[model samples]
Target chain A: MTYCVGLKLDRGLVFASDTRTNAGLDNISTFKKLQVWEAPGDRVITLLSSGNLAITQAVISLLNEQIRSSADTSRTLMTVETMFQAARLIGSAVREVRKIDGEALEANADNFSVTFILGGQIKGEEPRLFQVYSAGNFIEVGEDTPYLQIGEHKYGKPILDRVTRTDMRLGEAAKLVLLSFDSTLRSNLSVGMPMDLLLYNADSFTADRQLRIEKDDPYFQKLSQDWSDALRDSFASMDELEV
Target chain B: MTYCVGLKLDRGLVFASDTRTNAGLDNISTFKKLQVWEAPGDRVITLLSSGNLAITQAVISLLNEQIRSSADTSRTLMTVETMFQAARLIGSAVREVRKIDGEALEANADNFSVTFILGGQIKGEEPRLFQVYSAGNFIEVGEDTPYLQIGEHKYGKPILDRVTRTDMRLGEAAKLVLLSFDSTLRSNLSVGMPMDLLLYNADSFTADRQLRIEKDDPYFQKLSQDWSDALRDSFASMDELEV
Candidate 1:
């Protein structure tokens, strides 16, 4: 039970992920689901993961190991030549974790599940966002639908379907994204706060505009309260079915 | 593969069910998911069902047979003194269907699944609402929630969560209910149009106010279009997150 959404706007990419993970209702804890790899002026790759925490953390650790290893400077995410290559590298990392743990998890009737949102830029290419699956396959955001979401997605989806466009301003899109989170958080208990939010400006090649939203974050509180009031007002304004 | 919602409001109850049912992507068909049994001035009961069409149809057929026979003079829905008894009758009908088909379905690796929302009243009781599960257990709507939904419910739930209360006007609540369906219809392929919608008034004990919304229904079209515009306008009014 997690919710992470990434929007590929005309400006850049906006990524947000909740911090709650639970093995069951009673065993809940906070964990970072957003992983960032930035090599200033060269590449900026961001990932938001969901599903079995152990698998996601393992996949992230494995990717970090490759970056730390002196043996493979040619092909870590930081060295990937393009955003497409970075997505492929993430796919391989997931498959690597699956190879090691999928069988044991299956025997226990626990799914060997994990999914990721991979977004950012590598020099010479435009900013791109992709959703990578548990099977190590992926789909990229297209202009017609310039956003992707994973985990507890349905409650937040209708708003995105209605409003998301490729040309939205980064701040405007961030506002919509948080409203989406507001819908999800209100409906689902498993997806809780403080969320990690990052707004990437295309071609910046740096991940500096990131914020962590706590439960009491004043701006989010105001936005959430305002959206609720607006929805009620809007609902009241609609003509009731008269037939 | 279906969406049905039943809301218990101050006035009475509201029920809406999509007509689409599918066995697979290639084998989809339109079927009536809302069943109404009314003996004008005696009782008015509406049942909205979801899950294996076979099971639900079988359950309804069994209940109809009992009413048609001269044998069950005391306990048919028309004769039941309270809405609670009517709910129990529906649950027993479900269990009878399972007794006959459960093992066969399980042998074929199919689930013996069906759920229903039963809402209405008999002569002696106030309007009531209940959700009957596959195992013949049921839950009555309390004042705290006052509504129940089954099948592809998440996309439609947030709006209900935000706006539903025990004291809403029947027409206002009906507007909210149809808007909930609009959200589901936009996101899910298996829930489609020509929906059966019924609104009951307390103490009337007659089923009237029922309307079938065809795909080309002008009022529905206007409502759907208006909702989208209203949402976009509402989004515009909300302040953007500045952090």
Candidate 2:
């Protein structure tokens, strides 16, 4: 299991994904799940993946392979004209991996489930966030629901449901995303960190505000501690149940 | 789908269960998942069920049928010697339902998955809490982890993890449990109101302190609104992310 969240605020798109991957309890290891493709001022795309590591890595490799060949610019992540087209390219990449490996995985009772969060900007269109399903179908975040999360999502969702808005500033959205991670990390063991954080300012068309927060990052530690204390206080302030 | 929680606090046990039952997104209705059996001053036992409504209702009916027979008091919930024995009785009831319906459900490609949280006090012993599984096995909660939840649990779990304590007063625990429900009802469609809440003080040996909170219950409406506001404020109080 893993946890990754992408927020499409008016100011920008903010994304975060944990680095932990495990087959069993004892076989845990750190692996980066966030990938970025940049054509400098032309386009910037951020992708975060969760589910079967082999499948996600294969999809990423196929994507990178397409980028390197450059023979079909329309199909490459770096050259896709719109975020919608880029999403379709990813969907095709997933189906390509499925056509290769889905059956054997099914026979072995190994799941081929993989999901991706793709969010970023092209020159003309605004920043957009999408949640791509294992079936390769996808849905975009909109004003009403400006955030999307994949993998181990329920534990951290309440805070996002309450605090997130499309007009939120990029920094404030980043804080909300980290707070979301804080709740997830405390309750679930499958999603561990040092986390990969990416902040793309809307219309900037560049991936400049990115940070890799180590497990012991002081700011995260302080934020987590403060959030916990504040949450408890808020809980305590509620009226006592008369019944 | 349903959401039921049982907390074993030093003061006693608190149980809450939503009344929603659904076959799918469109076929949803109300059904109580909380059951109680009491022998006045002798013992008080509360049961919360989650999973297939058919299996749970059958299990409850089986338990009630046994209670009605009364020829063998030792095998009945009212005559159970200890809380552990009471848990065993419920587990056996689950198995009885499985024996009757498991194969038929399997043939239809339907699942027989069901779970239960049992908590309360019997005479001559301290309060005890056990989570009974479909396979007639159960595990008790201890001091370290003082609460058990089943069915659609994760969305509301973080708050329970952060604030629940064995020494919490019954009223305080009830408040926390409601806050947990507030989170669940907001995020999940399968779990809804009206909710059945049961609070049992330690060694009370009677089934009392029960409340059925209707969908339009004023207190619950106020609590939910207050919690939403307090939570947002708590989140806002956190520092802006440096990144």
Candidate 3:
């Protein structure tokens, strides 16, 4: 299990993902689930993945391999003309990984589940976010629903549903995603730190604002403690149930 | 889908359940999921159910018939001498319903799924809460986890995980349960009002504080609005992410 969220606000895109992976309770490990692709002034793409780590890593490696080989520059993330095309490239990679591993996984009664949230800006396009399914289909975030979440999403979703908006400032969106992650972390053991956060200012085409929030990072620690205290205070202040 | 929660506090017990039932997106209707069985000063038992409306209703009807027939008093809720016994009786009723419907439902590729949270007091015992599974097995709320939730539980669980405690007051527990319900209501269409709430003071053996919170109920409306506003205010007050 994992918890990753991407918010597409008017000012920019904010992404966060926990680095915890477990194959049963005893086989837990930390592995970064956030991947970034940047081509200086051309494109800046971020991918947050959840589900089978092998499959996600395989798909990501294939994409990176394509970029490294540069045999088909037009089809790679660095040269994709639009975010939609980049998402398609990712979907294709996911399907390719499935074709290679899905059958063996099915035979073992293991799910080949993998999902990704891909968001970024291409040179000539406005910033966009998409939730790419294992089936190689994808859906872009709509104005009404400006965020996409993958993995262990429910515990953190209410806050996002209530507070996220397209017009929210980049800094506020970042804070919102952190709070969402905080909720998930408290309730679920499968999602743990350190967390990877990426804040992309629209049209920047650079991955300069990425941060890794370790378990003891002061800001994350303070934010989580403060949020918990605030919730308790709010709950204490609510009017008593009359009935 | 449904949402029901039970809290066991030092002062008493609190239970809440939403009433909406749906077979699919198009077939939605109102149906009560909270049922109370009391022997006045002898015992007070409340059951909040979710999953397979027909199965839950069947279980409840069987229990009610058992109480009415009086043929085997030992097997009825009114005759149960302890909260544990009451839970077992309810579990038995569940298994009985499964025996009658399980095969037919499975043949149609339907799940005979039903789960329940039962809470109350029987005269000589302390207030108790149990989560009854479809298998007719159950687990009581322990000191460490003073609450149990069933159906669409994750969305509302963070608050309960944060604020609930054995020492919390009945009023605060009531508020927490409502807050939990509020979160579920906002995120899930399948769990909606009107909601039934029951607050039982320890050793009282009577459910005099039961309330039905209708969609337009003034207090519920105000609480929901205030909670949303408070959450937004909290989010606004949080420090901005530096990275």
Candidate 4:
């Protein structure tokens, strides 16, 4: 019941995540799914998560614990010189969470689940993006595939498939992601308001554009309204099947 | 897997279904998913199905048998007085199939699943559409809800949400259906080429337009190509998020 999308474009990376999570319809709550680890000019890493909140929280807390513990942890994400190593650190953290809670979650018939979109710069390397799956394995964003999405992904997939590419501008991509999220939120009840959006400029090593869109945010309201009008206009313009 | 969409517009109805069905990745085949039962100017009932091939085929076979015995059998789709009765007949047919094959399928862990989009006109009634679920119960389309889609539905849902309304022109609605199907076919391997598309004009009690679009069909190819381009163009045209 979440929709989070990360785009790796020529400019840098764009991340968007809806804040709604629910155990059931009546148990709905808003929780920010984007976590930023900023060492300012040195490194800036953002983590966007989906799936079971418990598992994702465990993984994030464990990673933060490592960052706090002596700062000399060999495979720590902040200390890692390359994006690939940061990804490995995330995978290791996921596996560590599984080791502690996987069996208990299975006992309750809740299959241990966690998926993440990890994107940022790590001092020495260029900004990169990766999607880590439930099995703790991961894949990087290639030029041909410039985006990654998790949670209620299908409702938002068509837009991404049709529009995104390597040469896409980060700003345009950010709007597309919001539009995609808007469509999903309209169709699905599980993904709701109060979304977190972040735009990172490659090699800037600083989160340049970040916005928290609440339920009544003016920009999102306009974007959704514009989309509806555009769709209607486009549909009206297409030649009909003569019946 | 399959993708079938049925739209109930003010002027008439539109139904579209993909032809692909797969037992596995390597065992994919083309099987027509749209079934039409028409008695000239009397009734024109089109049923678009998705889910287990065997179960749906069984339902169709039952209806076909009834039609074949129309001379003796009083209950047939073409002879039905109301769209409601027609839905019940289809539901009864579904339950009949489940009565015969539900347990063995369950034993094999194959969920007894099949859903259908039934839309058309019976002489006495206005154009109506219904979505029949696995349990054999069905819900009729209303003015408030103008469209119903089954199977791999999410990939194509955004456009429908944005554009479809009670006041849309039949032509515009039909084009929207095609775009929705195009989006679905692009993203999911289970939904594929050679689609069955039928458009029923109100009060005609017969199909006014129908086309079977194949992979090499010129219009379809053009539509698919144009849609992707239209999407990219829309993305570029939208004002970028100022970051």
Q: Whose TM-score is greatest here?
A: 1
TM-score between model 4 and native: 0.96
The ten-residue window of minimal lDDT in model 2 chain A covers A70-79
Candidate 1 structure quality by residue, lDDT tens digits, A1-243:
899999998889999999999989999999999999999999899999999999999999999999999877569887889889999999999999999999999999999889999999999999999999999999998877888999999999999999887888888998999989999999899999999999999989999999999999988999888878878888898888875
lDDT (10s digit) by residue, model 4, range B100-177: 999999999999999999989998788899999999999998878789999999889988877788766676776788
lDDT, residue B6, model 1: 94
Q: Give the per-residue lDDT digits (tens) of candidate 3, residues A83-162.
A: 99999999999999999999999999998899999999988889999999989899999888888999999999999988
Candidate 1 stretches greater than 4 Å from native: none
The segments of candidate 2 whose C-alpha lies over 4 angstroms from its true place after superposition are A70-74
**Every candidate's CA RMSD:** 1.1, 1.4, 1.5, 1.7
**DockQ, 0 to 1 scale, candidate 1:** 0.80
TM-score per candidate: 0.98, 0.97, 0.97, 0.96
lDDT per residue for candidate 3 within B9-93, as digits (tens), equals 8999999999999988999999889899887888889999999988998999998888899566456888778888888888899
Give i-RMS (Å) per prediction.
Answer: 1.1, 1.0, 1.0, 1.9
lDDT of 2 by residue, A1-243 (tens): 999999887788999999999989889999999999988888999999999999999999999999888566456887778999999989999999999999999999999999999998998998888989998989988777888899999999999998888888888888888988988998888999999999898778888889999889998999888888888888788788888
Candidate 1 deviation (Cα RMSD): 1.1
| Model 4 interface DockQ | 0.66
Q: Put the candidates in DockQ order, highest first.
A: 2, 1, 3, 4
Against the true structure, whose lDDT is highest?
1
Q: Give the Å shift of residue B79 in candidate 4.
A: 2.5
